[model samples]
Target: MLLKRLQPMMFQARRNYVELMFQVMGRALQAISDVDEPTREEVRALPEGFLFEMQVMPNGPKLIVEHTGDGKLHFHGDTAPRPVDLSIQFKHMAHAFLVLSFQEKTSVAFANDRMLVDGDVSYAVRMTRVLNRLESFILPKLVAQRAVKEYPADIHLPEKLMSSARIYLKVATQFVETVRA
Candidate 1:
């Protein structure tokens, strides 16, 4: 009887955490995608209306961003209104949080069966590259190295400093936008 009484509360707590996870991730992705010119170019080059979704399992929270060929990403307030071109689904909240916290790399999570990919393989690969770029900008060099397949050899001190400054400012701006909306 006591277990049953606590079940709903536990579920609600989990739901809240998942929703927060998606919201934070959405802002971070927006920040990274907003400032990087190369990443913006890559997003623009994607097929029009391409939607990418990263979701937690069992119909909890999801973050959906679309590439509209306008050099900017459209982050959906709700779920993806249109069909998803590529979906990376985490097996559970734990797995999703692990990746979000940078304890597990995205590639490592996928390779270890912690995630499911549903869509075109080639497009997913491209999307992985884009995600890697974002991770590089946001994560420290040690963490980013684990998260990405390879670090760019040409990222020198001046460029790294500039990129870090832009990424930090963008993240702050996105946080404000998220809070305001």
Candidate 2:
């Protein structure tokens, strides 16, 4: 499976690049939602104000955002000292992030066992709201662009299996669209 090849590379990378991107994007959303001048100032000050520990694993990473009374987003590795205020897990940090980027409802994915989250329910709820607000601001620009990259070489699959898989995929896609409609 492609996952077998990719999983090792993902772990070795260590930094969880995808998770870091989400943190930056999520913080931007929080900044946009700030109500008053003071809140806006607080949000502006957040780049260095909050502390977050990110851990990506077989089930994905957990993100703990700690906004100290002061203002700074202190990023920590998985083995940080403070207790986690929130945690989210997915098959990979990439999948967790794509769920947010694609504007898919995480609850549906979570219910289907595709994602898992724990710790302060209120914080999770607030995160969802923040994501919703962010989606409106980000999706339009994202969807308008095309993302295509050429592989070093074309991959070959067993002919019979490839044909069968194509047929199955087409049918499955149609079925999903029908159900959604």
The models' CA-based lDDT, in order, is 0.77, 0.45
For lDDT, the strongest prediction is: 1
Error of 2 at 125 (Å): 1.7
lDDT of 1 by residue, 10-45 (tens): 767766776776765566566657767877877776
What is candidate 2's lDDT per residue for 114-161, written digit by digit as tens? Answer: 665666556555444444433333334344121111111222235323
Q: How accurate is candidate 2 locally (lDDT)?
A: 0.45
Give stretches of model 1 more than 4 Å off.
1-18
lDDT of 1 at 47: 83
